[model samples]
Structure formats: structure tokens, C-alpha cells
Target: MYTFIISIILLVAGYFTYGKYIEKMFGVKEERATPAYVNQDGVDYLPMSSNKNSLIQLLNIAGVGPIFGPIMGALYGPVAFIWIVLGCIFAGAVHDYLTGMISIRNRGAHLPELAGKFLGKVMKHVVNAFAILLLILVGTVFVTSPASLLHNLMNGKVSLLIITLFIFGYYILATLLPIDKIIGRFYPIFGALLLVASLGVGGMLIIQQVPIPELTLANLHPDQMPIFPLLFLTITCGALSGFHATQTPIISRTTQTEKQGRKIFYGMMIAEGIIAMVWAAAAMSLFQGANGLNELLATGGTGLVVSEVAKVTLGAVVGTLAVLGVIVLPITSGDTAFRSARMIIADYIKLPQFSMKKRLLIAVPLFVISIALTQIDFNILWRYFSWANQATAAIALFVGAMYLFIARKNYWVALIPGAFILYTTTVYILNAEIGFRQSLNVSYVAGAVISVVLVILFFKAAQKSRAAELSLEVDISDYRNIAS
Candidate 1:
């Protein structure tokens, strides 16, 4: 219990302290006009108040990952607390703030464009495909999860196919309409429900004095899954998720000022960390122990655990509301995933998005692909998504580090976390069924080798980027002097 409370406090404090340092390092320009104002197209690039932007940003990134992932992470015992706090503070929030602010500085470019600019031209195409694939997977998973949950809630009275089609239709409307029309308007209401759900469950657990397990380094899993890479991958959203990078640009284009980046990006991630911490604590305290949690998980999975916990803690009336809140997380994220895909494709093709016809040109095919993906098994899609998600995160962090390096700021803030997650991403695929399927020792050694090589290559690119940036600055200064 003390560990859990301390972890939450640390996360909040980290935002005020470390988060402030990050803001300072990035050098926020309050006077600088944002993309929303400069490029007011009444579509994606329209300014919104900080409060609205923060709410949208929170819901946009707060997929079921925070709830489901932490519930699963509870099987590993209180050690999950450590990852949620540290990973969120250092890697997750930093990745988000940098990505959002950098996008604003670059006319609201998406991750692929930013990746290409910072990482390399080749990475632009690679990361483009990588990000679009991740978004589609996210969209498809979110749609299926919510539709299934809603079907179960209705006791299978409603056809799953109908619920799914209904959701896909909503996604189309949300993606096709202006940002403020569907997403910007509905997200605040959804954000309120999300808060009520998490806070209600977390508050009750504390009020009831549920005995949350204290932190320990011991391997507490019933299956004794190694905590090294698996735990990191298992808990991404509340800790650090590359998916947030894609979502941040959505708000980045809508932000009225650079100052809000800290709140909308960094602060909301802390909010998610709090949400994650609460769920992890609740899952740990409610179940008999790690063994009990594992048994239930193996039998019924995350949805069952969520339903049981909500009903037990919050009662049937409010628990139902909480479940609705959980449903909201995925639906909100899914729409934006399709929306981001549309924007990314439009940007890639250099198509003007002032008209609906141009937007549909990209959005139509994305929805078609997402619809096709629904036929694939959810678990299989998740397995591939898990690695790709973290890989996307690693790349985003490297991009952040590169941006800071070129700007002559403290690049280590992003570089260290980027390196750690890169190692995790590397080791997981090498050992997982999806990738090379190597032995643990082979994975460890090979992952290290691969990470080292990549870091060296990153530095090479950074050096070239930094030199070019410096030359540009000098040229600007010289041109200014001549004009004067």
C-alpha cells in the first residue's frame, strides 16, 4: 500500500519537476504562432482551448492498454508499479511532449514525416509504413474489443456483427467530419466518464483499505515469466507507448500555444500513469494473489477481470458505468487511429485536404483495410502489434533525441529511454514466436549487439543533422546582419 501511494506521488512530482525541466530544455516559445492559428483549415488545423485539447489528448491515448495491460502486469506483482512510474515519467511523457512540440514546430507533421526529417529519408518511408500499420492494428483491435464487450453486456441479444458495423460506421463519421465536430466535441464527455470510473474504483479500494502488495524485486508470476522485456511490453500505454506519438500530432495541430504541450502531452501521460497505478493496485489487492490473478486471467482474460473488479468494488450500477468508461477508451482511440491514418496518407501524397473528396481518397482505403483486418484473430493481431508498438516507441524516442541534439539541447533525456526500449523491442522479437525465436541468451546478446549498432548509426545521423542545423543557424544570422 505504501509502495502504491508512493508510486503515484512520485509520478505527480515527476511531472512538476522533470516535466518542467523537459519543457525548459525544449525551449517553449509562448509568442510563436501555432499551426492551428497559422493554418486554420476548419479541418484538422484549428485551435482549441487548453482544457479541451488536454481532454482530447488524454482520451486519444488512453486506450484499453492502460487498464488491460496493468491488470495483466499485476501477475508480475508490485514490480509493475516501478515500470509504470519510471517508464511513464522518463520515456512515455518525454516521448509525447517532444513529439507534440516538434510537430507544432514543423507545421504539424506526423510521426513518419518527423521520423524522416530526424531519423533519415529511408526511415520516413519505413516509419510511415510502420506507423500506418500500427494505427490500423490499433483501430481494428479497439473496434473488436469494444464491440465484443458491448455484445457480452447485452447477453448476446444484439448481434456482434451489427454492433461491429455500427462502430465502423461511427469511425467513418468521426474520421470524415471535422476534428471539432465529432472527436473534439464528444471526447470531453467521454473524458469525464473515464475519470469517474478510474477515480471511483481507485477511491473505493483506498476507502476499503484493500491490502495492496508492497514492492519487491522477486519474480511473482505463476508462470515465472521473466520481468525483463515481457513486463515492459505487457504494460505500454500507462507507461510508454509509441501509439501516443501518432496521437500527439493530432492535438499538436490543434493546440493554440506551445505552453499547452506540457499539459496536454506530459501532464495527461501522468494522468494515465495514475489511472494505470490505480488499476494495477486494484487488480493486485482484489485477487487472492498473483496466482489467483493468473488463474482467472488464463480462464476468462482481461475483460472478465475488469467486469468482476468493477462490480465487486463499485457495485452493479456504477460498475456498469465504469465498464462503459472502459469501452470509451478504445472507441475514442480507434476513431483517431483512422483519422491519423487519413492525415498521414494525405500528407504523404501531398494532397490538399481542404475538401471532403481529397480526405475520402485516403480514408476510404484505410477503413477498407481495417475492416479486412477484423477477420484476423485478435490475439494474433495483438502479438504482432505488441512488438510493432514498442518498436514504434523506440523509433519515436530516437527521433526526439535527434531533434534535441540538432537543437543543441540535453538529448540524453530521450536518448537513454530510447536506448532501453530499443533493447527491449529487440530482445522480445528475437525470442518471441513472431520473430527469430532464439534462445534467451542468444536474444540477450543479439539484442545488445543490435542496439549498440543502431545507437552508433543514430549518432552518425545526429552528427550530420547537427552540423547542418548549425550551418543553417549561421546562415540565418548572416542573412539577418546583411538585412540590418
Candidate 2:
């Protein structure tokens, strides 16, 4: 209890202290006009209330990730609490803030453009392909998951095909409409239900006096998954995810001032960190204990555990409401994945999105691709999504380090996390289900060597960036506003 309580306090306090420090370190200026106001075309780039931006950013990133991921992480026992609290403060929130601020500074550029600016053109091209594929996977996965859950909750009253079409229709509408009309208006209510559900579970746990799992380093996982890296991957969204970087540009185009970046970006991540903690505790307590949770998880899937937890904790109509709120989590994210995909496509083809016809030209094909992707099994989609998601994050973290190095500010903030994540993802690929299938020992040795080399490259690049800053061929600032 003491560990959990202190961790929460540290994260909230981190906002005023570390969050503000990062904002200053990145050179946020009050007088600089943001893209939303400077490049308003009444479409993608338009000014919105800071409050609305915060809510959209929250739902855009949160989805079912914080709830579902943490529920799986709990199978590893109470160690998840430590990871969520510390990871959010030092890594996740930092990643989200810096990436968003970087986008703002570059005239609200998306991740591919930002990556191209900081990294080289080759990386830019690679990330462009990566960003599109990942978004499609995310969009399709979120669509099917929610539609299927709604199907189950209704006890098959609604056909899955009909429900999926309805959900996909929502995605198309949200993707095409102006920000304020659909997403900005509806997200707040969905965000409220999400917060209420998580908070209600927390309160019920305390009132019922359920046994909260004790904090320990002991591995309680029945599958014996190593905690060093698997925990990091399993708890991807709550701790750090590359997916958040893709979403950042969506809100980036709407920010009114650079000053709001910390609150809108960093502050929302910390709020998500809290939501993760609340669900982790509730899942453990409601199952009687962490050991019980591992047993339950072993027998079921993420969606199963989440539905059971909500039904058992909230109960009756409120439980149903909470489950509906959970449904909103994925549906919100799925639509925005397409929205982000649309922005990427517009930028790629050098097309503007002011007219409905132009927007359809970009979106029509993207939806067709997503609809086909939904046919692949969920487990396969998730495997690709999991690795692709973290791989993107590792790349984003490296891109951030490059930004810091080019500016000649302290680069350690991004560099350290970059290397750690790089090492973990590399090791996971080499040994886990997806990659080379090498032994763990081989993965560890190779990962360590590569990580060290990457660190060395970062420093060398910083020195070269110092020498090359004024002579770069691309002067992106010349048309930053008129372009993406």
C-alpha cells in the first residue's frame, strides 16, 4: 500500500517539477504562434480549446491499452506497480512530451516528417512505411475487438458483421469530419465514463477490503516469462508506446500555444499512468490476490479478464455501463488510427484535405485495406501490432535523442531511454515469438553489443550535428506552414 500510494504521488508531483523542466529544456516559447492558429484551413489544422485537446489526446492514447495491458502485467505480480509509476515519470511521459513538442516546433509535422528531419532521409522513408502499416493494424484491431465485445455483451443479438460495419462507419465519419464537429465533441463524454469506471473500481476495492498484492521482486508468472523485458513489452501502453507518437501529431496540429504541450501531452500521459495503476490494483484485489490473477489469466484472454473484472467489481447496470465505457476505449482509438493514417497519406501525396472530395480520395482506399485486414485472426494481428508498436517507439525515442543532440542540449533524457528500449526490443525480436528464435543467452549478448554501438553512434552524431547544423541542404522552415 505504501509503495503504491507513494508511486502515485511521485507521478503527480513529477508534472510540476520534471514536466515543467522538460518544457523549458525544449525551449517552449509563449509568443510563438502555433500551427493551429497560423495554418487554420478549417480542416486538419485548426485551433481547439486546450481542455478539448487534453480529452482527445487522452482517449486517443488511452483506448483499452492502459486497462488491458496492465491486466496482463498483473500476472507477473505486483511488480507492475513499480514499472507503471517509474516508467511513466521517467520514460513514457518524457517520450510523449518531447515528441509532441518537437512536432509543434516543426509546424505540426507528423512522426515520419519529424523522423526525417532529425534522422536521415532513409530513416524517414522507413518510418513512413512503418507508420502507415502500424496505423492500419491498430485501426483494424481496435475495430474488430470492440465490435466483437459488443457482440458478446449483447449475447449475439446483433450480428458481428452488422456491428463491425456500424463501427467501421463511425471510423470513416470521424476520419473525414473536422476535429471539433465529431471527435472533440464526443470524446469528453467517453473520457468521463472511462475515468469513472477506473475510479469506481478503485473505490470498491478499498471499501470491500480486498487483499491488495504485496510489492515484491519475486517472479510469480506461471509461464516463467522473464520480467526484465517481457514485463516492459506486456505493459507497453501504460509505460511507453510508439503508438502514442503517431497520435501526438493529431493533437499537435490543434495546440494553440507551445506552453500547453506539457499539460496536453505530458500531463495526459501521467493521467493515463494513474488509470493504469487503478485498474492493476482493482484486477488483483477483485481476484482475491495476484496468484489468483495468474490462474485466471492462464485460463482466459485479455478481453475475458477485463470483462470479468468489470462485471465482478462494478456489478449490475453500472457494470454494464463500465463495460460499455471499455468498448468506447478501442472504438475511439480505431477511428483515430485511420485519422492519423489519413494525415500521413495527405502529407505523402502532397495533397491538402480542405475539400470533402480530396479527403475521400485519401481515405477510401485506406478503409478498404483496413476492412480486409480485419479478416486476419486477432492473435496474429496483435503479434504484429505488439512488436511493430514498440519498434516504432524505439525509433521515436532515437529520433528524440537526435533532436536533442542537434540542438546541443543535454541528450541523455532521450538517449538513455532510447538505448534501453532499443536493447529490449532487439532482444525480444531475437528470442521471443516473432524474430530469429535464438536462445536468450545469444539474444542478450547481441542486444548488449548493439546497444553499446548505438550509444556510441548517438554521441558521434551529436558532434557531427554541431559541425553540420548550419550547412544542411534541407531548410524545412521555409515552407513549414504551407506544407505538412
Candidate 3:
């Protein structure tokens, strides 16, 4: 209980302290007009109030990942608390802010464009494909998840196929239309649903006065998954996801000024961290402890645990609403994934986005591909999706580190986290059941060696971007001057 409460308090404090410092270090200027103001295209790049932007940013990044990931992570005991609090403050929020601000600084450049600018041309193409695949996977996974959940809620009276088509129809419409029309409008309503669901369970825990597991270092994973890499991987979206960086460019374009960057980007991520912490505690508390939670998870998986938990914790009707509210997490995030897929394809090919036909030209094919993907088993697809999500973060972290290095700021802020994520992804890839099937000790040593090499690569890229920054001629000296 102390851990849970203190973690939330620390996140708020993190905002004014580290969040403010990072904002200033990045040199967010009130005087500078954002891309939204500079290139108001009503379609994707339109300005909005900071309040709405904040909510959109929250919902965009807050998928079932936080809710689901932390619930699973809670099985690791209260160590999840440490990861959520420290990871959000130092790693996740910083990753999102830097990437988002970098997008804003570069006239709403997407993640691939940002990587290309800092990491070099070769990486540009690599990350471009990487980001698109991850987004597609996200869109696909997001679609199937909510549809299945909703179908189960209705006792399969409503076919998953119909729910899926209806949802994908929304994604197609949302993708083709102007930003302000569908997404910018109803996303907040969905956002409210997610919040109420989170707070509903959260408030119940408090009212019931359930005893959250005390903070401990014990490795409670039933498989005896290592506390370091597996816990980090299992809890990717909640603590820090490269996935959020993809979503960053969306809000980067809509933001009114650079001054709002910290609030929307950094602050929103902190909000997710709080949401994650609460869910983690509630899952643990409601299960009578992490062990019971893990046993249920082994038998039933995450979705079943979710429905059972919501119905048990919040009552029947409200619980139905809460569970559907949980469904809102994926549906909202999935469409944005498709929306981002369209935007990314347009940006990559340099296609004009003003016309509905042009947007459809890109979006129709993407949605078809996503619908095709729905045929695959969810567990199989998610294993790859999970890796893809963190791998994206690994790249974005490097991009941010490279940007900071070019700016002559403390690149350590991003570099360390990037290196750590790189190690986790590497370790998991080599050692997981679906992976290369290496022994644990072998993978551990390999991950550590690779992690060090990643750090070395960071230094090399920093130096590389130093000369490249001058040649590219994008102004970094304002931030550079601030760094001094």
C-alpha cells in the first residue's frame, strides 16, 4: 500500500521536477509557433487546446498494455512499483518527450524521419519499415483484441466477425477523415471511459482497504522468469514502450506550442504510469496476492482475468461498463495505429494527404492487410508484437540519445534506457520459448555484452550526428546553448 501510494505521489513530483527540467533542457519556447499553427491542414495537422491534446495523448499511448501489462507484472510482486515509478520518470516519459519534441522541431516528422535525421540514412529506411510493421501489428492486434473481448461479453451472441468489421470500419473512417472530425472528437469520450474504469477499480481497492503486497525483491514469476529482463519485457507498455514514440508524432503536429510538449508528452506518460501502478496493485490485491494472480493467469490468460476481475471487483452492470471501458483501450489505440499507418505511408512516399482519395489509396490496403492479420491466433501474433513494440522503443531511445548528443545535452537521459531495452529485447529474442532457445546463462551473458556494445554505438552515433546536424542545417544550437 505504501509502495502504491508513494509511487503515485512520486510521479506527480517527477513532473514538476524532472519533467520541467527536461522540458527546459529541450528548450521548449513559448515564442515558437508549432507545426499545427504553421501548417494547419485541418486533416491531420490542426491545432487544439492543450486540455484535449493531453487527453488524446493519454488515450493514444494508454492501450490495454498498461492495464494488461501491469496486471501481469504484478505477479512479479511489488517490484512492479519500482519499475513503474522510476521507469516512467527517467526512461519512458523522457523517451516520449524527446521523440515527440523532436517531431515537433522537425515540422512533425515521424519516427522514421527522426531516426533518419539523427541515426543516418541507412537507419532511416530500416526504421521506416520497422515503424510501419510495428504500427500494422499494433492496429491488427488492437482490432482483434477488443472484438474478441466484446464478443465474449455478449456471450458470443454478437459474432467477433461483425464486431471486428464494425471496428475496422471505424478505423477506416477515422483514417480517411480529417483529424478533428472523428478522432479528435470522440477519442476523449473513450478516454473518459478508460479513466472511469481505471478509477473504478482503483477506488474500490481503496474503499475495500485491500492489503497490497509489500515491496519485495522476490522473483514471483511462476516460470521463474528473471526479474530483470522478463519483468521489463512483460511490462513494456506500462513502464516504457517505443510504441508511444510512434503515437508521439500524432500529438506533436496538433500541439499549439512547444511549451505544451512536457504536459502532453511527458505528463501524459506519467499519467499512464499512475494508471499502471493502480491496476498492478488492484490485480494483486483482488487476487489475494501475486501468486494467486499468476495461477489464474496461467489457467485463463489476461482477457479472462480481466473479465473476472472487473465483474468481481466493480459489480455486474458497472463491471460490464468497466470491462467494455477496458475494451476502449485497444479500440481507441488500434484505429490510431491504422491512422498512423496511413500518415506514415504518406510521409514515406511523399504523397499528398489533403484529398480523401489519397488517404484512401494508402488506408484501404492497410486495413485489408490488418483484417487479413486477424485470422492469426492472438497469442502467436502478440509474442511478435510485444517484441516489435519494445524493439521500436529501442530504436527511438537511440534516436533520442543521438538527438541529445547532437544538442550537446545529457544524452545519458535516453542512452541508458535505450541500452537497457536493447539488452532486454536481445535477451528475450535469444531465450524465450518461441525464440532461439538458448540457455538462460548463455543469453544473460550475451545480453550484457550486447548492452555494452549498444552503449558504445550510442557514443558513435552521437559523434556521427554531431557533424550531420551541422550539415543537415536544422537548428540545434538553441538547445545546444541551453545545454551549456
Candidate 4:
């Protein structure tokens, strides 16, 4: 009981401290100019629709990651929550908010294009490549995780091929359908199903008088005492995630008011954090440390932890419903992934004569590749994906630093986040023990060194820009005085 209370307190406090701070900083001001690009598209660029509530956005953005990451974090005991909450505040929310706002201000341009404007054409392509690689890694992991869960629920009766086809077909439908119509109509139905499934499992656990084990700091697993994976997963949005960069912009493009961006983005992310906490609690309550680890390994992914919890909490019937709900969330994520990837490709490669066709062409192959990769081990894939995802986010921090230097004449705010992410990610890379992990670590080390170099270059560029502006102002003032 005390643990649950503490978790809730931490979540609420973090939300108020970091989430609301960002909100207050970017809050609506009557005199502030409406971003020009946002004004141009009244149809798509309007503030969030009145019909759209915060819950739908929450469900849309929260995927299997939130469920699984926390379970993995729980392997390290209660200490994991500290990193999750703090990381979300300083790293995750800031990235989501700034990237979303920038995209909105730049006429729904995604992260890569914004990077180009701030970082230059060469760095722009570098960032875009990084972003795309992150997306592919994220998309592939998401695809495999849920498919594995679905396969288990079907008692392994469903062939991987059929699962891939079903997922691919769903993406195609989501893509062909208009964005507003799909999100507005289908998402609410899916969200409600998820709520019912989660609650149903909870209700059954209560009715069945299932035993809740007494948790203690001493009882925590000693072998898995490492904090870095918890740090890695915590920032990944079961606790917090860089993937929110893609999600925030999608929500931003549809938001009805500039103010609502904070509400939607932060609100949804917090809700996800809460969901992750609940799953972590559920895992602890349902299984012992070794059992939980074995279950995750036996089922072939972390998502199985949620399904297994539901099966134990409820009977098979309701458990099946829980599995289906789990599947839907990732499907929504995949839909978003496909759309975002298409948007990225469209922005970078002009196929003016064949725009829609070009986007579909890019999306289909990417989806196919992702589905093929789904056959691999999900745990290993997730670890790689999380690291790659953070690396891209590190680059985004550099871009944000440049923005701050240009607009505020102070780069400390963005620089601090960038530096922290770089350090944490480097620690993660160095500690990782995969095959060729050392080589990968060296690459990231090199990347971090380059990021620091770029930070210096950006400051120089900002100084030149400021100098030119000052010169123009002085010449104009002198001419006016002479004429007078």
C-alpha cells in the first residue's frame, strides 16, 4: 500500500514540477503572434477538435512499451521509479514539447527538417538518417513485440506470416483512411476497450482474493541490481521515451488550441507512466523475481508479462480480452509510425508529380521490412532499439540547443538536457555487453564527441547571426539620425 502511494506521489509530483513547468513557460499569451505556418492550414492545423479528449491521445501514444518497460524496471526493485520520474521530467517531456512546438511552428515539418534549419544541410541529412534509423528500430520492435504476444495468446496456433499480414493490412487501412476520421472515430472505441480490459482484470483479481505479496527492499533481485537498463527503459516511455517526438507532432497538427498541446502531450505521457507503474505492480504481485524473469524469457518478450498477469488475475476469457487490448495499442502505434515515416520521406524527397504514390511506395517497403525483422528475438531487439532511439534523441537535444541559442541568446537550457542525455547514453553504451558492443560503444563515443563539436559550431553560428543583426540595426539608426 505504501509503495503504491509513493509511486502515485512521485508521478503527481513529477507531473506538476516538470510537466506543468513546461506548460507555464509555453502557456497561451494573448499578445504573442500565432505561428505563421499554423495559420496557413485552417483545416488540418486547427487546435485539437472539441470532440477529441485527453484520454484518446493518451491511449494513442501509450503502447506496449509502457507496459513492458516497467516490468523490466521492476526487476531492479523500487529504485527504478526514481529514474523513471526524473528522466521523464528533465529529458522526455522537454524533447516531446520542444519538438512538437517546433514542428507546429514550421508548418507541421517533422524533426529532420527542423534539424536542417538549425544545424545546416549536411547535418540535416545526418539527423534525418538518424531519425529514420530510430523510427525503423522502434517500428520493428513494436511490430515484433505485439505479434509475439498475439501468437502466444493463440497458443502458438497463429502463424507468424498470418500475424504479419493482419498487421500489414491494418496499417494499409489506417493509411488509406483520412487521419481525422480514423483517429476521431476508431481511437475512442479502441481506448474504451482497453480501459474495460484493464479494469476487468483488476476487478477479477480483487474478487478472487488473489494474494498480494509483501514487498520489501531486501526481497528485490540482487543479480539484476544494475541501474542502467532501468535508466534506459525508464526514459524509453514505459517510463519516458524519445518516440514521443513523433507522437507529439501528430497530436500538435490536430490540436484545437496551442494551449492544449501541453495538456495532450504531458497528460498522455503521464497517463502512460501511470499505466506502466500499474503493470509493474501487477508483475510484482503476480510472480516472484525468478518466475517473472523466466516468464518474460519463456514467452519471448516483455509484453507477455502483462498478458500473463491478466491471465492469472482473470480467467482465460477476460485474459484473452486483455491480450487483444494490448495488441490494439501497438497497432495504433504502428499506424502512427507508418504515417510519420511517410511524412519524413515526403518532406525530404520531392516527388511532386507522384506525391501520394511516392509516400505509399516508401511506406509499404518499410512495413514489409519491419514485419520480416519481427521474427528475431524481441528482448535483444528492444535493447538495441532503445539505445538507437536515445541516440537520435541526443541529436535532437543538439538541435534544441541551437534553437535556444538563436531565440533566447542563451543555450544553457537546451545544452543541459543535451549534455545529460549524452552522458547517460554513453554510460548505457559502455555498460552494454552484446556482440560487437564495444565497437558500437566506440561509435557512440565518437558521436558524442561530434555532438560536443557541433555545439561549439552552433554557438559560433549564433554569434555571427547576432552580429549581422546588430550591424543592420546600427546602420539604420545612423541613417535616420543623419536625415533628421
Estimated TM-score for each candidate:
0.96, 0.94, 0.94, 0.82
| Per-residue lDDT over 37-70 for candidate 4, one digit per residue giving the tens place of the 0 to 100 score | 2332432234445246465566656777777777
* Cα error of candidate 4 at position 317, Å: 3.6
Candidate 1 error regions (>4 Å): 217-223, 470-484
- Mind giving the per-residue lDDT tens digits that candidate 3 earns over 1-484? 7777888899999999999999988787676667786667889888888889998899899878898889888887877888888989999999999989989888788999888878878888999899889999989989888887888889989988899889998888877898889888998898888889888887887787778777754534434646867788778777899889889999988988788889999999998998898788888888767668878888867877888778877898998999988898888888788888888889989998999889889988888788788898988888888888898998999988887787788888888888888998999988988898999889999989988977887687677658666432234333211111
Each candidate's lDDT (Cα)? Answer: 0.90, 0.83, 0.84, 0.63
Candidate 4 global lDDT:
0.63
Worst 10 residues of 2 by lDDT: 470-479
Per-residue lDDT over 1-484 for candidate 1, one digit per residue giving the tens place of the 0 to 100 score: 8998899899999999999999998998776777787667999999888999999999999989899899988888888998999999999999999999989888798999998888878999999999999999999999999998898778899999999999999999999999999999999999999999999998898888889998765544435568888999999999999999999999988998788889999999999999999999989989799778888888877888888888989999999999999999999999999999889988998998899998888989998998999999988988888888999999999989998898888999999999999999999999998999999899999999999999999999899888877321111111121110
Question: Given candidate 3, what's the lDDT at residue 371?
Answer: 79
lDDT of 2 by residue, 200-312 (tens): 87667667666777775454442465786788888878888889999999999899887889999999999999888878877767776657777777776666677787888
- Any residue pairs clashing in model 3, and if so which? 242-393
Better of 1 and 4 by lDDT: 1
Task: For model 4, state the Cα shift of residue 1 in Å.
Answer: 3.2
Better of 2 and 4 by TM-score: 2
Going through the candidates in order, what is the number of backbone clashes in each? 0, 0, 1, 11
Q: Highest TM-score: which candidate?
A: 1
Best by lDDT: 1
Give me the displacement of residue 318 in model 3, in angstroms: 1.8
Query: Which residue runs does candidate 3 get wrong by more than 4 Å?
Result: 217-223, 468-484
